[model samples]
Target: MTADRLQPVLAGVMLALVGFASSFAVVLAGLQAVGATSEQAASGLLALLIAQAVGVIWLSRRHRIPLVLAWSTPGAALLVSSGAVEGGWRAAVGAFLVVGALILLTALWPRLGDLIAAIPTPIAQAMLAGVLLSICVEPVRVLLDRPFLVAPILVVWVVLLRVAPKLAVPGAFVATLVVITGYLVDHGAPDLSLAPQVVWTEPTLNWQAVVGLAVPLYVVTMASQNVPGVAVLATFGYRVPWRESMTVTGLGTAAGAMAGGHAVNLAAITAAMAASPESHPDRDRRWIAAYTSGWAYLVLAAVSTALVGVVSAAPHGLVEVVAGLALLGTLGGALKGATESETGREAAVVTFVVAASGVAFGGVGAAFWALLAGLVVHGVLKLGRPSAPRM
Candidate 1:
């Protein structure tokens, strides 16, 4: 088990970097949108890291589950949008607590977990595809805007993913860094500066924010994000306890929220690296990798907004193009897998359309709609049993 976990420990660091880069912007922006000073935001992000590490390590060790935790990208987006309407750190904290409570409560309901499992694999896959489609689209937009700059790298990435799947993601990141370096050589990139005085804001409580932001945060994090996250684990042959994992997610977010961070949840994309054969063949050993990732997250969280200062210095389009291209294979596979089966194909289509529709109500995201629609359709189809031919 020790040897099995060692290689994954290395890969886990890469996965953490990927997860951090993909969603840190949302964290920063959401914190700022909710009125956290640069320093307080940094502290909040650190708190988030602590929560994630504790959740992943404890849950993985206890359940031998290889669990991985991350802040919800969609939930962050929702929080930022919510902040736009319900401004202030107090509101954000209120929303965070509300969502945390909901996640914890949801975990208590065994039937809910069973219902989530009942979602046809194909339909769930379609929802995954729909959610990721936007991510995949960014590389093309980058190509159109700066074809001379991003095209060659995009081509190389796609080819590598097809021919050498294992190196696909890292290769893309390396290629983008090279391009970004070249761009910086000719045109100086943005300046990097540490915050003069770290800003910290005390959290306040607000009932309206709880309704407008908190509930939505929980719904989006769980229904849209965590559900598929578990599917990924199952797909890889890991049988994790849903309730326990959900509890960790809830507690993690709650801790982060107390420090002024928003929703956190199980990581789907980064989980693949740990779960994959490249990480470890012995499933039992993968926990070490998750353990290591939690530690790395703590370091990043401690560094706070300074980390953002460094990332902000890089070319934005470069990162987006690279990240999007890197995810292409995974997204394509997910989308294709979701729509492949005939039995769940139509439901899958509806799930995808509704999820990608960008609808929102009272801070809830499009995913809630998608999941709700899929469930209704799935339930109706299941219930509408044809009368047995008159015997």
Candidate 2:
């Protein structure tokens, strides 16, 4: 292949590596938080990888757009903080199905799609920024907590950002691998089998799980994942078929739920990696990166069990620091987008503060509340404005 063709392939691999290395730990923690055993957690990761691989590859090929897919990191964070439900992980799986069905409904109904689309861009961006603010601060927190291990990683990331902007995150991944490898060698590897297993958890829906998990999962997955995902594609001038993509992700999530996975939606941060100019000079060909990323995800799924084992053994804050480093660019972009417009600035700030506050009301997460608060503030302010003079 010519260098032009080869670059996208490499970019795809880099995107996959960063995606997995950064957040797989969070996925595991989320599963365990919801009362999943190690086997179930591994199965969930595998299921998610498979579903995202199929969705991303199909959508990118069908639409000729770099449409990357990701398991909802924010949804996982919600699971982590929400604690164990009464019906356990099975109930959570049911909640995942509810979210999937909601997304699918949004795709099938034009009015629903229009309503979601009507959300002001600044509010969506602010909500995303708020959702991500906590995760974005981890590198600094890690620096203070484990400077020896995290400091070099940060230094490497900074140096690469200056000298090779495209490779900055990939370089951090490499540094992380080296650190992890040395740690394993020093403290003998954990005794864990690398066998991939598919665990099916029958969905058991309850009113509590529906109100607590289903509603918040749907909200954050839409606000924090899908909305920003579309924004990322638009940033590179790709007019994505938003409804169709949502439909595919929704179906993918439903399929994954049977196998113990959570929501699968369009990617936000990693989508930028695949869709950016650095991935390919010719925007039309960036779909190649998405396709390659799909294949890479499938490969990762094949080794999901082993990957989870490795991450499970790592130091407490190590994976989080890596994730934070990978997300720095994305966080900066969200902050900039959230504050760029004067009209929406106050509402956006309200959204950001509410989301970052991590407050929960009636078992629902702050993300949903943040969007609602911002809209209420926006609407009230608009109403207070004096009517324009008649023509």
lDDT of 1 by residue, 209-249 (tens): 66556654665576557877887889988876878887888
Model 2 whole-model lDDT (C-alpha atoms): 0.82
Clashes of each: 2, 0
- Give lDDT: candidate 1, residue 310: 45
lDDT of 2 by residue, 171-241 (tens): 88678767877889998988976878899999999877887678767876887788778888898898879
TM-score of 2: 0.84
Residue-level error in angstroms, candidate 1, position 343: 3.6
Off by over 4 Å in 2: 1-15, 18-38, 62-66, 74-88, 206-212, 223-243, 268-288
Give the top-scoring candidate (TM-score): 2
Clashes of 1: 2
Q: What is the C-alpha lDDT of each candidate?
A: 0.68, 0.82
